[model samples]
Target: MALEDVPRLGCGRSIDEVWAGIDQPPTGHEEHCQYCQTARTRLQRLQEATVALRESDLHDPELKPRPGLTRAIMDVARAEVRRGNRLLVRTTDHGTIEISEQALDSLIRIAATAIPGIHSRRCRIDIRTLPNSPHETTSTARAPRLVINFRVAAAAGIDIPKTVDALRQKIRTAIPAGIGIDAGTINITVEDLYDV
Candidate 1:
């Protein structure tokens, strides 16, 4: 018989049901049912394995979340509630280049983290478009200029101004290199200090 046609257990209790109540003391019926005993044993082993994996991930530095992870998550959540904003990079007769705010925020975070002893925090990007001239065509209209406001935490004993300068340079380079657009004005704020 096909797997779908077979009953989950001889006692008619599914493995899922047994697993859900695994923490509680087994009922009288479970004590007498071989299927319940077997399912419970297997599920206990699975739970043990899951716990072990979580511990491993915690100890692994590479698996640790980046500095701005919480901010990034909140940004995504807000974007979901209100549709994500997109920036126009360039416009041509053939097509236009655009990048989502979420994507650009992620890129900026990546650039900030590249500098040692720096942890990214909140990042916000603003765009201002110059009014089109009467003679300017759609393809010829100027692209919007971007302003980036970024917050970060610096490690103790690090030179704040020098490190921030490096961070600004990195973002300027990364923006144009990663996506074909210039980073107009970058403002970096050192909000807090963290131990190494």
Candidate 2:
């Protein structure tokens, strides 16, 4: 079953809601609800494992993560943060300029937030270089392309379709010229719903 459709307890509480209230004394539903019981068992095991892991990390130097692991992880993270999202913009006065993916993400976030009922949570911009098919032996000109994906948490009781269309319009207008993506390809997903 989907998470939203999971059977709640008699008190209309889900496993997650109860999990959040972990510090509180257990209620009748928590004891009787099969979902809650199962969740509690899993959580208890996880808690034990976490304690064990931390203790081992403190006491056993051999069990610790390898040296340079932090540097390696940071390197990969920096590479990901720097790569594939730069937008080549056509500038009239100053020739050509490249806008970083981070800038594009910020632009998307701003545009999305301008829509009354939607707030952007995250924005990702992907710029790809077109590759030639295997059948074509001769090399083709590398044409750059762009795709935008954004997730939003929207207020309840709004028309989602209309919201998406308006969001698309806003992004199209805000994007600087020369990012080769058509408006139709810019994707928007309302990944969450919240009460305001």
Best by TM-score: 1
TM-scores of the candidates are 0.56, 0.45
How does model 2 fare in lDDT?
Answer: 0.73
| TM-score: model 2 vs. ground truth | 0.45
lDDT of 1 by residue, 54-139 (tens): 99898988996898999999998987855678877676767877778889999999998789999999989998778878776565
* Cα lDDT listed for each candidate: 0.87, 0.73
Residue 100, candidate 2: alpha-carbon lDDT:
87
Per-residue C-alpha lDDT of model 2 across residues 76-151, encoded as one tens digit per residue: 9988887755665433344556778787777677777789889888777776656556554332233446677888
Residue 10 error, candidate 2, Å: 37
Native-to-model Cα distance after best TM-score fit, residue 129 in candidate 1, in Å: 1.3
